[model samples]
Target: MTRRLLALSILLCPLLAACSLEPLINHQVVDYFEANDIASNQVILQNILRAKDGAPLHFSELASIRGSLSNGASVSTTFPFMAPDHATTLPRKLGTVGMTITSSPSFDIDSLDTQDFTNGVMRPITPETAQFFLNEGIDYRMVLLLLVSGLRSGGRPEMLLNAPNSSRVVCYHELPALNALPTQYSILEADEPCDGQSEPEFYAFLRTINHLGRLYPLSVPQPPKPVGRPFDLDMTKALTAVASIDPGRYSLARLASGQYQLMSAAHGSYVILCRETPDGPAVAGVLTSERDESTPVPVDACSRKHGNAADQHASGDPAGAAQPMMMIGEQKNTVVFKLRSTLEVIQYVGQILALQQDETEANPQLPERCVTLEYENYKGGNMTCNFGVLFHLQRAGPAFSSPLNAVSYNGVSWSLPAPKVCRAPTRCDHTLETISVISLLLNQNKSSKDIAKTQAVQVVP
Candidate 1:
């Protein structure tokens, strides 16, 4: 019996040793295989999440991937795996973790109660609040999620749940599910993947507004006007001023009945004939010519000629022909003056006709005035003069007859109009009018429905 037991023990010892050795060898092999696989895949995953320079992938790129996965959009990508000594190889397949992105129901921002939020414990979501969350190391994506949730949930205030104990915050969308369970749903990190069963969906609405606010942190939405329709224009109380004159440089002067002159440099003068209207003042007519008097010759030449003739007349002449000569000279001067004055009137008329013909179409608001002057000298000397329109003025004030002043050529004296006051009780603000004009122009290109939709979606801070 002792000999039989010893023989059995000897057989059992070999079997036990074989069992232990087999398990040890298998574990070492499995560990080595897993370590190599992880090393290769780590490079691929890092490349997918970040660029070679370490910057995180852009949202658009990530969105494109998400869209392709959801919509089955054809996507082909190659990830290079780096090996020792700059050797590279492509990864056959990458393992994917389960992720689900679902859309939540739409809600109106206006319906939110902005005054009472978070049971009056915390303030509503604002730029300041958003910044506070960012400073606390909250990712922009999570911050946006909270803000959008608050905006959708009637401006409810958001708080960090289990913050002191755990750095996680409860998502409003998961509140209904969390309430039913003993455990609370919380976000552990900004980039924490959504667990389809536990976390389910991520709220993604108002994406454009969220992106704009987050990326351009300095930009804030402006509050809409308290009263008055956008781009409203009341022509009755609209500000009016002479169009052709620059209010900054020239002053308006009432030269005659129904005729107003902008006193500036003689070359820079503007003439406007205004008629009182229910809409302030309307320009009845505009003066197209400069106030100028022409002599037979240049003014200096005429003066010199007159002085010479006077001196000759005063000098004693033996023949009485000197008197006839003086008389002839006087006649010549009179004829030259008459001719010059007639030519000036003709030139003025021609300028008005040219302006009416749209010769200055190149510049619509301020047209170029072309004037030609022909001076005929009785002494067989003639000259031609050409000039362009000078004054370029923009409207300045609400009152049409407001005192507009202009600098003289000497820059010392100013041409001023009679004291005129605006009797209209209400006048359009120039700044507001400008904005209205631009808004009107932009709205003209959009349909009424489109305009309404845009206004509804506009976010005002």
Candidate 2:
């Protein structure tokens, strides 16, 4: 009886170990990335198993990896989940433990172009290609996953997968070595800018990858803020207004996660503010640098162009240079002049003191319209700077009933709301006068060193 019991116990030990994942890990590629995070565990496992490793394997490695996780804490960093509606408490789960197995047939890779292969479905895995990965003990699933991931996300496989390039895989690899990428696989493709529309497919793809990486993915917010939206500049009586805050820093793709700081400024202008944020792998923002305008402006003189005043053409004729204002009041105040001379200049100035006066005396809801001033050189080097006042008349309320006051121009407070508007110019005209208003308010006495320090926004190393 004692011998019989001992035999039964010994038999069960092998079965239990076989049912677990501990033994096969080192023999498989998933272990390498598991040695990397929890969310990626399943993806890594699937990809490794599907790669070129030539062998039939057991199922124990999968279960063992899953069992090893301690509430989202694998061998990697701890995932701390925040609780909802509460600040001090913690959530039950900090990270996700995926139930899907990499070897599971349900996994679908849509990015691969299989129609070109011999069977018209799946490509044959040759021993030569398999040998490279097999030597590293990578499975077919992992091999295919890596290939697909690389292809979809602008990797080497993308080139070969494209037409005309499909016939030359070896030749592609023969090119020069690049930053850890084969020259064939490392071309950086440009992406089209978002056109303020919903991008469901892209959003899903990114989310899937993030989930594979074990990260909590966030969707882009609506009305995607421009990377470098300019502030309104009204310089009538006295300039007074709050500068817009920086749109957070964006992390470029291919970099690891961490805080990245950047500076924002007017394009081809000056950097007026500095902002810092943790840029993720896909966000983009402005650097505190100026773009060269030595090249001619790209807009054709024939097509009417539009944007802020800074983008205006060199032509100074008011009729040819006139651009539609963003608001009715701004349009009403705008004055255009036909150029008779060689130069044309338009300047917008406003003050906060007038706004305060108007708010106190008249209608409080309506602020003064932007001040429009234009100057043109006709003949004999003659130039005149004309000015006008704009008033909004829509307010009929009892609490506010005065005409719009002049804006305060002194730099007393940077927090005031001093909004201004200017339409960008279009077309090239040799006879058109040019608008060139130097910002007198800009600190001209500042040393070049000081200006450089402000623009670069870098710590002296």
Model 1 whole-model lDDT (C-alpha atoms): 0.26
Clashes of each: 10, 56
Q: Local error of candidate 1 at 44, Å?
A: 41
* Model 1 residue 224 CA deviation in Å: 3.7
Overall lDDT per candidate, in order of appearance: 0.26, 0.23
| Candidate 2 lDDT by residue in tens digits, 117-215 | 212112222222322332443222222222121112221122122111112222222432221222222222224333232222311222222222211
Error of 2 at 90 (Å): 73
Candidate 1: list runs displaced more than 4 Å: 1-119, 135-138, 142-199, 202-216, 229-461
Task: For candidate 1, write residues 77-169 as lDDT tens digits.
Answer: 334466436448445543222323232222121211223221221222233433444455433333332232211111122222211112232
TM-score result, candidate 2: 0.14
TM-score of each: 0.14, 0.14
RMSD of each: 41.4, 36.4
